[model samples]
Target: FQISLPSLKERVQDIPVLAKHFVAVFADKTNKAALEITDDYLAALKQYTWPGNIRELKNIIERSVILEEAGKLTTDTLPFEITHTQETGNLSSFDLALVEKQHIKKVLNYTKGNKTETARLLNIGLTTLYRKLEE
Candidate 1:
């Protein structure tokens, strides 16, 4: 007979239980009991969109444990970008043309559409700015 292990997302509710188990295991291995995971910490863990699943969660927990001093785990222990996106729900982008366009617009407005000043403010050559603007 064979049994298959459950995927982390399917077992999301088990995070707290697993965390406690990890605490015990790590404490015993390291001969330390200074770390305690708080309810808020667990809630954040539950809220996170774990794209990389259990392995990612375990790595994060280990990192937090190593960094934390004796006390309850705090939101600070979690990665900043994760927390930021979770809280603010901002759109992430990688469109270079869009970014350049936005920057050019802002600099142009700030300089009252003065091409020379906009170029200076943008730290780019005037010809480059003109080329970008043409596009």
Candidate 2:
């Protein structure tokens, strides 16, 4: 007998639960303490179409867990493709600079104004981060 499952996008509610489970599993594997996922992170996961289904979600969550530094899974750890595609309809402009500024602010908020960690999470040099802040 065969049983079929729905795509992750079709079951949006499950995204958070699955993400939490994956974070726990990966965190344990990496010998890290329990990690908590932020609501925004979960929202982003749910916003994605999940073309690769559950396996894709699992991979993304594992990647997030491994890359996480603040002991919490925030959208800063998510790939640009994923975070960039989320709810762009609400944006007033598609200009790269505006998007970058907004993204920097979001990461800063996630880091609780910790510029060093924000730069680290954004994968930019501390000097570059300050430069962007000046812009």
- Overall lDDT per candidate, in order of appearance: 0.72, 0.85
User: For model 1, where is the 10-residue window of minimal lDDT?
Assistant: 82-91
Q: Score residue 110 of candidate 2 by CA lDDT.
A: 76
- Residues 2-61, candidate 1: write the lDDT tens digits: 999877767879988877777666666666775788877888887777777777887777
The true-versus-predicted C-alpha distance at residue 31 of model 2, in Å, is: 0.5
Say what the RMSD of model 1 is. Answer: 11.2
Indicate which candidate wins on TM-score. Answer: 2
TM-scores of the candidates are 0.56, 0.67
Error of 2 at 27 (Å): 0.4
TM-score of 1: 0.56
Q: Can you write out model 2's per-residue Cα lDDT over 2-119, one digit (the tens) per residue?
A: 9998888899998878888888889999999999888889888888888899999999988998888879989888876677664464334356876798789978977899999999
